[model samples]
Target: MDEQQGRARRPGGRSARVRAAVHQAVTELVRERGYGNFAVGDIAARAGVADTSLYRRWGNLQALLSDVLLTRLNAQSPMPDTGSLAGDLRTHAANVAREVTGPDGLALVRLTLALSGEGQQGLQARDELLADRTRQLQAMLDRARGRGEDPPDVLEVLDHLLAPIYMRVLFGAGPLTPDYLDGLVDRLLA
Candidate 1:
């Protein structure tokens, strides 16, 4: 219901600010402590929201884990589809470089990989995220193939395309600059 029409609604207005805050709190806490030892009370306090609301919405940490991680990796970002393989790869590399180098992105990714072995649900979420990314990348390659480019070995290209970015993000091997992204694309394409 639209509040401007004077209809009744929840207290946080239409932007769902409380919901986002709670989810962010969850993400931060998970990044810090994984999913095992934290209490709902602590989470609620951290979020500055009611514990009841958190429980009512998330039920448990793993469910919220699935929602936030999968959303960030799969749905929150758009895949590059610039109609040419080189252009698409450059765009993809740049976007990923931006995301992985950011504070929240690095923490979330580190937490996801670090915590995946703790539970089946998290493992499944990680698996789904990987599959989603693979499908998106494959679509880009398939588009190039349709445009009369050589039939690409998608997996081989994926390694060549993503490894340097991951190494830079995870190990601080290099800066995630446009030069780095362009270099990766050039080397892969060459």
Candidate 2:
């Protein structure tokens, strides 16, 4: 290929821009209209792309939503690997708190919840999302075990740590104070 063709094929080109725009549009629409209110055409208009592009790339709205949620989840919460499990748990908890409370946080959470009820496609996406998160948690727990630390099971961590944070966010309980987060980690570890 010529240099011009190679440059045209470079990473982070029009394809990346289109994907980013579409993801942002989905996030905004979910925040504004909630899930299931908008269709792929709406997303295309908002993202300045053709509806066919979205359909061709993602197959359907559920697939696109799944991609957006998964991308946001992966981008927002990276696993922490401090030497001690406590440190890792604390960091992970804090990262979750921040994401759930961030500008697009509520929308993503609502999208996840909504996806679970949409039908077979939604159900599959929801299951995939849950599995992805479970895998992340299990990896951290495995690391703790490898270091000779006794760690709780993945469900325990989800139930005791993440569930509470999500509940607070959903219910508008209060700010996720550092003390409260640390307390959750400490209690789980105890």
Candidate 3:
């Protein structure tokens, strides 16, 4: 909802205030301290809301963090549609590379990997966070197919295209330069 619509519905409701405060605090904390060492109490203090409020809203730190991560991801870079498969793929890969190379993004990835291996909840959260990007790529591929251009398997294309970008970010192999992104697009299109 837009800001006016949100305000009209609640008009300074306590629940809305608490939710907004918690979200803001979580985002700030993640950007500052990384997700590896965040505590509920710290978030509550930062938000100036009771710990119970957060617990009631999110159930646990993991769930709250997952929501926050997904929100930020969606806001930072929306997947673009450039009309051409090569253009669209390059744009998508470049956006991913930019995020993965950032400090906040690296922390999010580490937290996601660690949590996702623990149980079904974590895995579900990970899948939810990735669903938008997955759909975006799939739509781009579908558009290409409709235009009589046969691309490789969508998942294979994503994995092959994103592998080097992740490697460079996760392993500190090299910088995520335009040249690297261009090379990835060329290889994928070939």
Candidate 4:
């Protein structure tokens, strides 16, 4: 509807502000106190929203955390397509490397690991996160195949590429140097 007809639009108005505030609060709290250390009221107080608003919107803290993690995941690591499978893999690995090494990245990784087995909600969140990642990888690999490139299986990519970067990040093994990232992709494609 048009504003001339007494109908107005509020794109990213109050709801968006509240959502952004809540997401920020969740991230900050996770960084400060870690997962399972804060309650719904704490989030509401930090976000300047009512507790009922959170419960009504997200049902529980676990659901809210899952949403935050998934949002961060999708926002950070977008799949790349660079004509060749090697280029695509290298670009994608670089994206992931940058994401995990970013300022909020370590806290996010800890949160994901912490949320893996708290309860039913935790399991569901992990499953959803993995499923989304799998879908993204599959889409990228399918694109490479369409280009007549022989791409490795998604699992192989995970093992040879993503898993190593994640392990390095999780354990502070070493810096994710470009040469190292390229090497992982090279090994996977080899």
Candidate 5:
């Protein structure tokens, strides 16, 4: 067996086992120790991997954590298409809410925000994350246009529907409920 397979066999060959362990260790370290306070050696020790292995795979803590955020958390949230703007948007908002309020999502947002304070590179990564979602939403808007149901400025409508959910998540000030999502859809469709 290869090294990754050997590691996986210990826990029923789940690929996530090792990745999850590493992600958890890095997340906890960042929360308890702060980003700048830890090094690659420290992360490797916490993750129970050799420093060389960690470096060879992820290159840096930021990239590793970003992978964890994207793969484990964000990737699990389903984006729905419901044949109408209101239906689709409500579904999307609900999915976003579910992810943003979860423990992993909060940790990811915290890490991303902390990393973003470092300068251009961090900001670029943060933007890239958001850009991916924006592109997805834009595609949905395009689909709506092709069906002749979209407004003139579909992008703006999508932003208006989604921005509040993001604000609530970032500020930790409000719940993202189905009612709220429905209201957002109503406003956007109105």
Candidate 6:
């Protein structure tokens, strides 16, 4: 197994086992069949859990899928500390692009968009995830400021870099090539 795959998911317990199984099943199914297909029964059968168990714990497939995304995206990654802010941003951009464009990751994004709903009240789970991402992005900018770099507005950075990249990922407007990644990092830091 790869390093990430080798890492333990959860300690033993009936509930933990069920969640782990469900997470594994979701990742597999999403990989095989993009976000729009796949039903709760399929997940339940693959997870070795009853439909009631899934419904009781997660309420619905969208919630379960969001939970899976939260589990993956909330993982603690070391902040880029490459001395110069530019280098750090490049590192961060590369990491973000990889995670955003990876097969499973893209599938999660697609799923989240489909189920994210219209307003704040509708996309509560997705809002929670956005908050988490906002905090993480703030931390990265804060680190740059701590090192004496006059970082630009965090929201501007998000608007310029993050949103466009996500658009590309979701819309397939262009390739996430090395040049594109480097250009984004350079333009943002400029």
Q: Tens digit of lDDT per residue, candidate 5, span 116-170?
A: 8867756766676656666677777777777888543646654676567777788
Q: Which ten contiguous residues of candidate 4 have the minimum total lDDT?
A: 1-10
**Ranked candidates, highest TM-score first:** 2, 4, 3, 6, 5, 1
lDDT of 4 by residue, 1-190 (tens): 1231121124457766777889999988988987888998999999999999888777777777877787777777778877888988999999888988888766556766777758787777767677877898899899989989899999999888988998999889999999999989888877
Provide the overall lDDT of each model, using Cα atoms, as 2-decimal numbers: 0.69, 0.86, 0.75, 0.81, 0.68, 0.74
Write model 6 residue lDDT over 19-40, tens digit each, in one string.
7999999989987886758888
Report, for all candidates in order, the number of backbone clashes. Answer: 0, 0, 0, 0, 0, 0
Candidate 6, superposed: residue stretches over 4 Å from native: 1-10, 36-41, 74-84, 117-122
Give the poorly placed runs of model 1, Cα more than 4 Å off: 1-22, 31-60, 74-76
Please give the lDDT score for candidate 2: 0.86
RMSD of 1: 5.7
The order by descending lDDT is 2, 4, 3, 6, 1, 5
TM-score (all chains, Cα) for each model? 0.70, 0.86, 0.78, 0.86, 0.72, 0.74
Q: What are the per-residue Cα lDDT tens digits for candidate 2 across 37-156?
A: 999999999999999988877777887887788777887888898888999999999999999898876755677778877888888877877787789889999999999999999999
* Candidate 3 local lDDT, 9-79, one digit each (tens): 48478766776787799878877886656788999999998888677667677777776776677767676
Task: State the RMSD for candidate 3.
Answer: 4.0
Look at candidate 1 and tell me the lDDT of residue 141. Answer: 85
How displaced is residue 53 in candidate 6, in Å?
A: 3.9
lDDT for model 1 comes to 0.69
